[model samples]
Target: MPKNSIQFQKSFSIPEFIQMYGTEMQCRERLFHLRWKNGYVCPDCGSKSYCELKSRPLYQ
Candidate 1:
């Protein structure tokens, strides 16, 4: 690894990580944002029109 490797950078402490993703809802929201930073986009048809399923943590 290089001296300034990205993995070696400590952006947040362990406590901070727990604080951000310490719950199911938190984790879900983070995943959603990471997946669709500019909003949801369909992988198949490349459509932005989609809906969230309340029965589970999923979007279709």
Candidate 2:
């Protein structure tokens, strides 16, 4: 049989994970990209212009 598809996935140790996503900013940036692979867009008006909210995790 062929190798399992999961075998091709990248593996990381705890230290590696921490190095890549240990900070809040890093986590947020990763999430933002994952959520919007094509960059951010306004949900209300479909505009690309937006201001990142400082008090909360949102775009306005």
Candidate 1 residue lDDT tens string, 1-60 = 358678678698889999999998898889889989998899999999988898986689
Q: For candidate 1, give the lDDT of residue 45.
A: 93
Model 2: pairs clashing at backbone N, Cα or C within 3 Å = none
Quote the lDDT for 52 in model 2: 77
Candidate 1: stretches off by over 4 Å: 1-7, 53-57
Worst 10 residues of 1 by lDDT: 1-10
1-60: candidate 2 lDDT, tens digit per residue: 888889888899999988878999888888889998999888889998888788987789
Global CA lDDT computed for model 2:
0.87
Q: How many clashes (backbone N, Cα, C below 3 Å) per candidate?
A: 0, 0
When summed lDDT is taken over every stretch of 10 residues in candidate 2, the lowest stretch is 49-58
